[model samples]
Target: MNKSVPANVTIVDHPLVQVKLTQMRRKETISSDFRRLLKEISLLLAYEVTRDLALTEREIETPIERAMFPVLRDREPCFISILRAGNGILDGMMDLLPSARVGHVGLYRDHETLEAVEYYYKVPSDIADREVIVVDPMLATGHTAVAAIERLKKDGAKNLKFLCLLAAPEGIAEFHKGHPDVPVFTASVDKKLNEHGYIVPGLGDAGDRIYGTK
Candidate 1:
């Protein structure tokens, strides 16, 4: 983990995660492979992000006997993906949390100011009452993340976590500055953002690669 990254930020550094990330970063990786890798990595990332979820004991009867089993105390957590690219991660996350409610926050960054402008936003009606995890493959400039978090907060979401496959130090800093209470999870925090505000060495525009737009 980079010392400069906020304490709240967690880097999932498992060997599998690293290998998958490396494969995804290669320019030659096809859209199908890229999408598959993203989903695989997102499931790995989901495990770490949901580690602290509250659990409760439940009385259940097994085939042989009755016993108390531990189960999630709350209803399934809500997942909010940040538009087009976020959908890639959402699929993997759902693999782990099949019952979780899903939401989408559509935002596009203004190339000139590097600010996020929201074009769409929607979430579960009970969003305010459940744990909410925001998923995006890359956290580059962080403006889009900050904007998305702000919107979630405004809509009464209190418990929030941001998850990404890769993050830039600049984005992490900006994110923490805007929403200090929200923790961030990522597979890797790369060197830094470039002049154009993209994470250096990041798996290029996640949406483009995942959907073969480029």
Candidate 2:
């Protein structure tokens, strides 16, 4: 399989991201704590993901003097969370971009076919003109990622990005191979996927960990 992931697809290696991930990995972390850490880590990841957002200057009058103000140049980025697991990451990103538009895509892996089956999808009507960031806590198989992107592309979204908490090498390769132009941001890339398609040494099912369900 192709191991060459995008050079632009950054995996954040900050100490804080690592520390929070460690807490998230612990088996004892309860749903509440897991949810909290997911939010915090998502915010940190957002910092890197949005670093290059265009900024514009505007003149402003301060209490004492006139000054130049800087704000995001393009329309604020829209967030598209990939359902249940993605919502954990979305909560944090929303705290940072509260005014930004939000979208949802619901997908489930069909047990029999092992395919990504979409049940619901909604996005801003003006997606073609806005930058979009797709969030999901885990990118395990890349099937969902590829399918999700395909849906987004069909919706007319141009500039698109994918962000995840963790990914496996196989999944990362699959994503890149399927959509080499899209950049991905992740916290860590694990060794590989196990027999049942779980990322080995991963923090278990992210949804189960965050929601306290099996």
- Candidate 1 is scored at a TM of 0.98
Q: 15-84, model 2: which lDDT tens digit per residue?
A: 9998999899898899999999999999999988988899999888989999899978889899999987
| Residue 41 C-alpha lDDT in model 2 | 98
Clashing pairs in 1: none
**Top lDDT prediction, candidate number:** 1
Report every candidate's CA lDDT: 0.93, 0.89
TM-score of each model, paired residue for residue: 0.98, 0.96
lDDT of 1: 0.93
lDDT, model 1, position 65: 98
| Model 2 alpha-carbon miss at residue 137, Å | 0.6
